[model samples]
Target: MESSLPSTQILDSGESAEGKNEAKNYNEVMSTLPKVKSLNGYDYYLYQGFWYAPFFLEGLMSVQEHFNPQSTDIFVASFPKTGTTWLKALTFAILTRSRLSGSTTSALLSKLPHDCVPFLEYDLAQNPSNRDLAIPLVSTHVPYSCLPKSIISASCKIIYICRDAKDAFVSLWYFLAKQRRSENVEPLPLEKSFELFCNGIANYGPYWDHLLGYWRASLEFPEKILFLTYEEMKKDTAAHVKKLAEFMGCSFTLEEEEGGEVQMIISLCSFEKLSNLEVNKNGKHRPDTSIAIQNSIYFRKGEIGDWANHLTPEMGARLDDIMDQKLKGSGLKLPR
Candidate 1:
């Protein structure tokens, strides 16, 4: 058998460049990787058996090289459009509520979740000397397999969120469509994107495989990883918030709950409140990057079964079959 893998590029400190042109260096490295076409009509590179969008590769390299995870650090991990924005908001609000309570201002009052709790990969890319790494509240869309070894070695706690395949697919499609429109590129057709999704070629997809990586990890190390579902969180926001608070080791005291702190957090992090906030509605996450996405782009309907408006019954059934087949015997159940 012949190996067709690209030349190996290990994570390096890049001290020689003094952190200059890191993105260019990463792009040069990416040019050498095995490449494939994605359903979204972009080039994805094959790295360690998983495909990744070229835009994220640079930041991922930064994460691999520089992220020195600590046990006290908390991570919010998820596949794209799986309520990641919402989770970040909730977690940040939960953990920082006490510290920020006395201030006249709130984090969410000015910063979006992506701003308050930055993505590990992209955030590190922008600010290589990130001061917050000591006890960071980081988020990432990277698959579990590709996460920096430091994250696992340091035993950092991770909160992983999963969504039903149908809804996730719908949300991902719209998200990508908006992105393409922002860049003045014609959006990938929905039917074509759906086919690619089923074939396991969408961004960070095979969704089931990505879900299983964390699902199995949570099963193996329940203490290190808390598995969550967007549907479940939406169904009982208060209960899930309590659970998240407990897992983060900052459970609300009875006195606080009695004072309605839980409800306060929920209201502050609510989809309606966050989405409509002037900052989130008009701000840009990273305006200078290749993927200069608006904060408002992350706010869609944020509901269940929006797929019904997009996917036909036959299409839904086909995805269901694929999910059933791929997740067979995995002991993982995504909300329907």
Candidate 2:
């Protein structure tokens, strides 16, 4: 548990020399990385051909330099807005079901899934006090190529979840709008957001490239990478939850399986059940930073193909065409 990064805020930022040095390094990366306009007003830096928010870039750099992964560690990896919250909830439940005993509910009832499984880069690496967390379970939005080398070299398992490109974009627009609204800043227009998104200029984006990075890696290292798509999970959640449990090295026992634990976990983490919880509806994930986002933004209509409601036919087909071209001959076909 040497790398267990605690969730509770610890005000040790100015006290530790390592924290200062990490902050200095983060600043250096922030200042030197090539910068571009983000979908919103904040600047995103083009690093390794994809765009990343400045804070997350700092986190990527910090996690790379310091996060030490153990073989037991399980990383839930994905691009933003790709059912990350859902995956985090399911993964946490599967891994910690032993502690749940006979109850259908778990900590998820009280904490946001993001709170239960903190982001390796954005949540932990961005917060200096959380630099060396001892926890084994972590999630990340960092692309596969940019992930901490320790995660790869240490031979840990990664559970990745993806969604249809169109749906992912739709979810992202709503999430961003909610964030900006919370801060009283004007959100980007949907058309403008779509334009930047197609160009691969959004946060942790160039969507096709981000998806392709892990898609290809999962192909090359099937044992180490359990790639999942949101559509597939929504189609049959129980089966996928079982797959996740197995991949995470905690497959349900015959008794547990027969006892309806799988279904219990699914229901416990379902969007409907979670969205109504007072904690999720009213709470805010206040990291040590000044920015505190409403937990409610994380819970929208977790419907597949909600893009139809948001994007026109032309916009949908255009993104699909782009993804098809980008993934052509790569043996990856995104759900249309």
lDDT of 2 by residue, 1-336 (tens): 001122222213545776666666666666777887777767788887778776667667767877776688888988889999999888888877887665445888888988888778665665534422444688888788888898899998888889899999889988988888777889889999999999888888888888889989999999999989999898999999988888877888999989889988888889999999999999988644565778899989999888999999999999999888999999988665
Q: Pick the candidate with the highest TM-score.
A: 2
What's the lDDT for residue 237 in model 1?
97
What TM-score would candidate 2 get against the native? 0.91
Candidate 2 ranges beyond 4 A from true positions = 1-22, 126-135
Residue-wise C-alpha lDDT for candidate 1, range 156-198, written one tens digit per residue = 9999998999999999989888877776778788999899889
Q: In model 1, how many backbone clashes occur?
A: 0
